[model samples]
Target chain A: MGLSLKTAVAIIEAALARGHELRLAPLTVAVLDAGGHLVALQREDNSGILRVEIASGKAWGALGMGIGSRELGERATKVPHFFNALAAASQGRLVPVAGGVLVRDASGIIGAVGISGDTSDNDEACALAGIAAAGLVGQTGARPAEA
Target chain B: MGLSLKTAVAIIEAALARGHELRLAPLTVAVLDAGGHLVALQREDNSGILRVEIASGKAWGALGMGIGSRELGERATKVPHFFNALAAASQGRLVPVAGGVLVRDASGIIGAVGISGDTSDNDEACALAGIAAAGLVGQTGARPAEA
Candidate 1:
């Protein structure tokens, strides 16, 4: 019912490769299936332990809202209380930020990719590049530069 | 990093088939990745709404303790407070019962499979058989009837 683990791992690898290419800080990337479950996760050396959790939170948030984290983040500004309650409801597994991007296949959103450790825009860029490298689409919305 | 969604689904299908072969009650099975996030889930028709949640809780508990739920269940009797706190920390996602088993490949523990909607022993047996069908191992501990 969602993206394959092989593809999910590919996305994380490609995202890490982009981080290396761009000389960004160490990053952690998490991929989640359509059910908002972790498929594959990778943390580059030196990425703090919390980065992985944060990345997972972003991906979970994107999957939960069926939108890119950027969109969710924007929505949070209008309904901070709601988002806060959601955060509590989700056991703090919600991170509405720019780094979470929906991964879409030909059918629709198969899953999501999330990145942490760099600037939010750059993290989202890495996530998008990673998804693209895997021959999938990423929903980056109105974020800034790609890389 | 985790079980592939494909393999997870395969495990559930195999478990469901086993349930039919054994003529047990309707069942719900859940597969979770190494990080304890649900990868795939299947609730047979007429299975209670709580079946999915129960399956997830069992899988989560197995993964959390790095042991089969059977063993965890045994431990829970001796140290109920610890298990209680764990359940709270996990937002009520802990079910240390016989139906939860670890999914392992040659490398190590890849994920976990959990079943509900029937007797715990029957549920664990189905989980073990399903893992075997998928060419993976299910850590059923020393629990009786299924090994």
Candidate 2:
């Protein structure tokens, strides 16, 4: 099944609760449908204005390429020159790093979540929490065939 | 001085060349002035339709906020609520994440470049090349200001 706006919003709310209970700093959360369209987004008041863009970019990248941002980050190191050129070419939508997770149902990828503000590990944790809250599997542990 | 159309074209050309040389796949490139207005855009054959929007959003966010997209990515972690609201409010124009860079002359920020198709790192590299071709510094290292 495709990711619905309802699920996306639920995921964001769960992430917010986790951050608050853990006393984490402000955060930005973004969810993109499998087709890489924005479905939901949220940023805290203390978060920088740019967070909105960053969170969206990460989720977009993950959904666009059908893989985790962490995998992209690993590949970037192997080809810095190419990666640099691509960064410029992409006009800033590509982010090759952790803190983003693909959402999966029984069928396939449904959507993605990207969080920023805390450490990468923490951000990923929040994403996972949100995924679980939405009653979907957080595909962080699954390796895409392309990866 | 604002980034001229000529400079923006130069950046796009350089980025395209790099993409071809690296065999990075079809891509889309966009250039924005310091104020986040579009100056030029190019979408390579076979690239997805959404590539144009992704690249444009990245560059627009970088140029509008006067910082690298990576910094914006970090900020999103702490304040997702506000970030998502802004993304919705921006109507797909704002993207905060690594893969876009500010174009800087000796004086100050002239514009920005954003590329998409390959990995985020590769897109960033292409933007850097375009900035260099335009005889400007690619401010990939600079972080966005805190909100």
Candidate 3:
């Protein structure tokens, strides 16, 4: 099944609420369906304009690679040139970063979530909180030390 | 406010419904935010594989130029070289055609909706119908003869 708009909004709201609870900086969140198409997005006031692009790129990269951005980041380090070519090919849509996570239902991957504005670690933590709050799975590498 | 997934879906559904009503053909509809980010897209069964890209390019061009693709098509005819340069600069993201319509709210332009899979006129008619059905404004220079 596709990611419902209601669920996408819930995920965004939960992420914002978690960020508020943790006192993280204002954040931008993007939720993309399996095809790397945006389902919903939110850019908190005062968040830099680039935040939305960064979040979208991260989520697009995660969905494109079928893995979280943290794992993609590791892979990028191993094969930088290939990823660079990919970035050009995708028109700069791929972003190998730490705050993109795969969203899954019991059936399998349904979508992904990306967050920006705070440190990558904190952004990831907030994304995880939102995914969990929505009763969906968020797949990523182990939490970083800062998170 | 940005285009929500719910509204995007409504647009797509309405377009597809109109397509069926007219018995044009299976269609593909794409919705993009003002930032030219994919909000949601659907390729109807039996629609050509390229329909998605065509729809996206139309919407992207409309959002990028702050005008409907019909107007963009007219401008392209007037300055083919400039339009060609824009296509290169945008990496083929812009399609100066007749099926893209701008989506506006009371405040201002929010995004665009594009449709493909039938004649361009029929596609634009469906897009306009979708935008209207979604409770948004759809602006184009004028209805094409066929539409």
Candidate 4:
């Protein structure tokens, strides 16, 4: 099912709340539909200016490859050249790092969320918290063994 | 003062409401800070996937040049070559059209809003309606006489 604006906003609110609770830095969050179109986004005041693009890029890359950015980060190390090419092809929107998670439902993948501002792992934690808050599943694209 | 996420969402909500009232096509709206960075954005479902980029480009161009895309469009007609070069230089982010508008407070130009997915004029109308809805002034970059 397509992600509604309400749900996207809920996810953003929850994500930011998690950041606030953890006393992390101000955050930026982006929710992208399956087609990698922005459904909703918010950049907290005083967040770095580039946070929005970086957040959206992380989610866009995850949605584009049907994998989470964490897994993509791992792969980037094995084949740096390929990941570089991918970044070029995607117009520098493929940010292969943590904080990108696939939003899933019983049907399949519905959308993705990306967060930025804190450490990659902390950002990913917020994403997962937000997804759970919205009663959806998040996949970080971890291999089954690692997961 | 900077463009707060709250004000940005208010603009998007009012813009979409205007579009719905007029029965216009699905619209995508983007809000950008004075630094030409995204503050918030939303694309209505079924709107073209490229709407996000187009909307952001429209606002980005306005903030980059300190004028609205409507004026930019006028200039593009007189200097096609210059405008073409500008497009290339911005990495294809400058979109000269009617829908981009500057958001102003009493202090000065604070940010910009862009709308896409309908005729450019209609898109601009929605942007104006939104800015007004938020109790802010919108500058379409129309010449003083035309305005």
Q: Pick the candidate with the highest TM-score.
A: 4
Candidate 4 lDDT over residue span A48-110, tens digit each: 998988899989999989999999999999999999999999999889999999998777889
Q: How close to the true structure is residue B75 of candidate 2, measured as C-alpha lDDT? A: 66
What would the per-residue lDDT of candidate 4 be over residues B6-69, giving only the tens digit for each residue?
8998999999999999999999999998888988888887888889889999998888788899
Model 2 TM-score, all chains together: 0.51
What DockQ would you assign to candidate 4? 0.71
Candidate 2 Cα deviation (angstroms), residue B72: 11
Candidate 3 clash figure, as a count: 0
Worst 10 residues of 2 chain A by lDDT: A138-147
- Per-residue CA lDDT of model 1 for B25-143, tens digit only, reads 98878787887765655566556757767887888888888889989999889999998998999888889888999988878888898999899999999999899999988886543
Clashing pairs in 3: none
Best by lDDT: 4
TM-score for each predicted model, relative to the true structure: 0.56, 0.51, 0.62, 0.91
Interface RMSD per candidate: 9.3, 10.2, 6.7, 1.1
Q: What is candidate 2's lDDT per residue for A1-147, written digit by digit as tens?
A: 588888989999999899988888678999999877789899875454556666776676677567787665566566655555544455566665677789888898888998877666788789989998988887653464332
Sorted on lDDT, best first, the list reads 4, 3, 1, 2
Candidate 2 lDDT at A91 equals 53
Calculate DockQ per candidate and list them.
0.07, 0.05, 0.10, 0.71
Docking class of 3: incorrect
Error of 4 at A147 (Å): 11
Superior by TM-score: candidate 1 or candidate 2 = 1
